[model samples]
Target chain A: MSEPTRGPKGRVEIKSEECKGCGTCVELCPQDVLLLGNDLNRMGYRAVTYKGDGCTGCGICFYACPEPGALSVYKIKDKALA
Target chain B: MARDTFTKAECLYDRYVRKTKVEPDQVSTHYCPGCGHGNVHKFVAETIDEMGLQDRTIFISPVGCSVFGYYYFHLSNVQAAHGRAPAVATALKRAHPNSIVISYQGDGDLAGIGGNEMLHAANRGEPVTMIFINNAIYGMTGGQMAPTTLLGMKTATTPAGRTARNEGGPIRVVELLSKLDGPVYLERVALTDAKQIYRARAAVRKAIQNQVENRGFSLVEILAPCPTGWKMDPVDARHWIEETMMQVFPLGVTCDRTKEIAPSEAKPVPFVHTDLRALLDIEDESEGFAPNRTHSEGVERGVRLKVAGFGGQGILLLGQGLAECGMGDGYEVSWLPSYGPEMRGGTAHCHVRISERPIGSPLVAESDVLIAMNRPSLERFLPDLVPGGTVLYDSSLIPDGVARSDVRAVAIPATQIANELGSPRTANMVMAGAFARATELFTVDHLKASLPRFVKAKATLAVNETAIDRGAAHMEKLLETVMT
Candidate 1:
């Protein structure tokens, strides 16, 4: 209800539940922005998410992630995934 | 399209993340050991990495030893059906014209069943880069005789040498496809040694760059080796590509439309118009359309014919022109160029299998009908005619020249009829007429309708109609006594 219009750069959302924790995307990430998530899911595989000030709005992670829609990278010149 | 974040700078293969110089962690290649496909994949990936197009490029991988290419390309890729990579590439290139679309396929994938897709895509000049691997056999299917199999090369089905009487010869794909006017750049390269591998990689980059610049259809057919399928060691495989494959599928550029493509004066890569239905359309008449053609049984529903004659005698057109007629008559039909180089002023032939059932095995060991435009073809193929099959030839060819006795042989004055029609080129149409009249292979009305599909000029179409009718009229009496 509080959300306003999102314009310009596209929104990228990470579907946390679908993550397979293959770590391929993590290893592939040239930015060193994604570290394995500290929170463990019921499946026991460590999930991956953006760390502090590390993500630099790179889309290569989107393609490198084989899991469909699990890891989406949004466009924000200022809001970094880190 | 919404803009997305990230580029190759974030990928694992980027120098910083690679840890070592080796990128794309060495996973066990899904391809068999020593297959050139692995090396080819490496070249493509390395080229894309060097070009910095990894995020923007899309790949279409065909079913073969290379089907698992998505694992290695480090880009968005969709695996395509066997022999269908060209078609898929055509579609993706049109829909996403800015993306660098590429198709990687084996010889059997590009030159056999997928041949139509390959030709149509190239003829239309799609801005897609194609990496054709000419390995001479259907590697994924366990070494079957592919359209690219060289004459005298043995395979699972052709354990004996592919002879003119049966398997014909290996198809020269680059040379054959180069004739299409729309292709802007065509090059046949190979990977026999270190220098050749370097050249092959450069060829890959060039083809990709051509697509990126919107020049036109660009293809680099790599004379790749299949050591497992060829029953050779890796070293010997390289030797074969140098010795045998190069003899037939010579390396270097065959046709390059790049002379006029100076990027300083060029437009962005143009989008290709590929009609899906047109690619798969079956010509047919409204009246004979069977609702349950799937299970219908009339006249046992089709015949397979092989026609052989010299290149200038209208040999190939005869089969294609008739196949068009049969297709118009609501019959399922496929016409394939006989496996071989198109002999210069020498023998040329085609295979036509018209059936309600789907066609299989373009190879013809026993044809329902054989039409020979000369004495040599008759002598060569007469022995393989099916029992009770019809063998028609030019009356000009005499009995001492023939080689078999089990089947029926009818000598029609095909050349005389064609010459009398005022066009020696009509000899091919004359044979088509004889075939149609003899077997009701398809109706003449339908055959005429199919004629214009092959010709863009209406005047030529009108002339061919006359020639075909004349051939049919000339052979009527003889056909009545010898055929159904």
Candidate 2:
């Protein structure tokens, strides 16, 4: 995965620190963009990580997260990348 | 993306109060894993914050796990009895029209115990929002069978899978609400998946928006997950809501008249005091009688008299006469009557309070004077008489058992006097006459003038007047003999 310093409006961010390893976002994400990482956070639960590069930022993952501030999406201006 | 890059929702409170007493440090939430209450709470709080309704919100939490809802939301929350959330919310909204009232209830509390309250509130088109969380079974009470429990579903109470023949059928709350004409918006949403969550959030927002616009009753039934009660994993619980619960309670907008129906003119009714002069049309007689210095100067408090007898003995009427006579003399008075189910032959009693100042309550537990017309009445009320209190009874009926050292228990031949007057019912008037002379509270003339309102028969009026005179004369002779 290409790591971007500044998340463009089209990208989505998952706060792996607060993720409960529920995998609800992974199963419900339409773009297949997220996956559970091998690493565990301070809460001792496996956190979700971004994988695919087609960043549409649909906000499905943001709404599905049970934990507060676990996911956030930024709308991208470029249509081609979405 | 990064770990710390996510932004918090603007509507969620910064911190939640710890609910459980044992875990004082557990500040996150009391909800079990996969429970939809946490999600719903976030959505509701966010909606209130977004709408700028934090100060105006009053949530009525029903008896369930969400009873601690006030601790979480940090708003003016009231805990209603089981199934009475809608009723409480209705009153709250009616009392304070500017406030936004929300009734949050669960399956068992709402559909099972509070079905009538919910139905009636919606039927009346009460301007309140309801967030109904239907998780199929009773989550708070270890998976008991709820009104919304699905067929063939196993719960703690229904160990052998729920049968339609035995457990009836699940209630479709959204469908039921949609059938009512008062509801402005009704929708059933679920928290099963991402797409479903989006729809649920929208539905909740719409329901609250309806209340804000004052558009009558709005209900949003949420198909929530209960993993512990369902005995399933969190993922499976979410899946079950989508697969099983949806089949029974379909996820959709059952009613939507937001645009068509205008906001109701349900303003709070201002209290208009009734003018006593116009309501009763009685002349102000307070200026006629001079205030008694003994009572008005606090040297004497007042008389708390209790009158007891058989129901047919006109005990209630005697007490009313005493109150009316005191009122006619420009004194504050109150009369309260009590009788059993068998109105005619049952035990009857009345409390009459007369004072220079306004009386507080009409219940006389410890009476200063007690007039008992029968043996049972004398036995029942003699102990409640205050020490040094005077008791008057009918010597003709109560032959004996007038033993008391502290109080003066006098017996008058009231029945014999009424028999002489050719009416058995005039016994109470005889007692009333003796009561007036013994207490020195009123004269026989004042007592007679108060009779027109209480006495119905004009023919018996002459006999009753003669009986009152005889009763007073008998008491006066007894007092003279005692003094000698």
Candidate 3:
């Protein structure tokens, strides 16, 4: 599995430094596109990471994540990547 | 190439620079992991941005885990005292009628300590939005049982588990507030799952929208999770809110009258000094009595006078009369009365300050002049007299006179003079006359002119006037004798 910054339709960016590894976004993500990474962030909690593909960019994960800047979801304007 | 559509909310500060402690990341909130406050804060920020209320919003942060709400939202913020968010919000909304005020409070703050404030603010139908986070426990103080704590919920204060008999059932705030006629919208939403959180965001938007439209008080009570306070994992806390807390606090709108009710038309009247005078029925300076020249001169450095006597001896009335006359003479004046419960016989004293400048304190701890109507009055307050201060005692009531030599003591038979004037009640006026002449603060004519303002009975006015003249004459004769 290669880590791609953006999928065909959308992108999800997780600021690892701000994540507390609560798994709220991972549990709430509809596309199963987020997971808690094995490496710990600066604050010593496992940080969330986006899967390489299949991100619908529903933005539910953004709302689910407690930290304000930890997660941001974006819908791609170009459809050709799909 | 992909272009971005959805992004972080604009209402939230880019970096929480206000979070003074820099150890934790400044880009993140101070709330614990999966804490409900963070989600609610995000929803509020998003709503503010959507509604374009960033410039007009004033957030009142309560004393709770979200006390640092000011640090996150890039809006005007005020941190209210514990449980006083509603009161603070009420004042803010009234003072700035054009602004949208939002009071953010927790269960312990809104329901427990500030319950009365919340209820009354709702009852008054103040045009403000309230976001209540009911975590069922005191999250900031460490899992103490709150008023919204569900039955059988074990907390630090409820180690035996909350019993209905001991702790009573949880308070349904939305239901209680729904019964009031003031609130235009009331809803309870939870932050348990994606669906519920979406509903909570909608409720938050609706509540604030109601305020923007001037629909009056709107409250959205969100059943939030406290993972650290509950001693549970973040996911389990969410499950507990869904399975347990939801059973006690059912989700949905408890009351909604947003359609039927009209937008608030009553605007707060801005405070004006002249308007206050008109409201109080006080005439303008041009139409009012002119200032007495002598009194203004005597009040250049201010005068602190203590009057003490038996209650029925008119100790308070004398002080009031002096204060009123001083006010009419264009001096800043204050009268503070202290008395026991008994109406007639109790010991009574009053402090009077007449000043050219504004009086700082009405308490005359040390007096420039002391008027003692009785022996105990003289003995009790004599020590507080400054050196070279004047003492005017009713010689008919206390024959011993003032014993101190350092202060000027003037003996006036005020009660006897009042009896000779045919009314014993006129003794206060006689003393007032002596005070005026002895201090040369004002003339007898000034007292007579102001007498009708305070002295109610029309029949006794003439006798009171005569009593004032006699007292002034007595003081004048004493001064003449001293000069000889």
What DockQ do the predictions score, one after another? 0.08, 0.27, 0.58
- Per-residue error at B88 for model 3, in Å? 2.2
DockQ of 2: 0.27
Ranking of all predicted structures according to TM-score, beginning with the best and ending with the worst: 3, 2, 1
Worst 10 residues of 3 chain B by lDDT: B290-299
Residue B441 local lDDT, model 1: 59
Better of 2 and 3 by TM-score: 3
Per-residue lDDT over B1-484 for candidate 1, one digit per residue giving the tens place of the 0 to 100 score: 2444422222223212222355333323445535677556656775676678878788888887777666656688889998788889877877777788889988888899798999999899887899999898999889999898988888898988677679777888778878989888888887675567667877888898887677889988888778789998655777788888888887888788776876532234453344443464533434434343554565476887888877777677778766766766667777877634655566777787888776776556678999988877777777778888988887754444345566777777777776777777777777777777778856776677777766557777766778778767766876665566
Candidate 1 ranges beyond 4 A from true positions = A1-82, B1-26, B264-484
lDDT of 3 by residue, B324-415 (tens): 87777777889999999999897999999988777789999999999999999999999999999999999999997788999999999999
Candidate 1 root-mean-square deviation in Å: 15.7
TM-scores for the candidates: 0.45, 0.79, 0.86
Which 10 consecutive residues of model 1 chain B have the lowest summed lDDT? B10-19
Model 3 — TM-score against the truth?
0.86
The TM-score, computed over Cα atoms with residue i paired to residue i, of candidate 1 is 0.45
Model 3's CAPRI class is medium
Best-fitting candidate, scored by lDDT: 3
lDDT string, candidate 1, A21-51, tens digits: 5454565566666766877754455677766
DockQ of candidate 3, scored on C-alphas against the true complex (2 decimals): 0.58
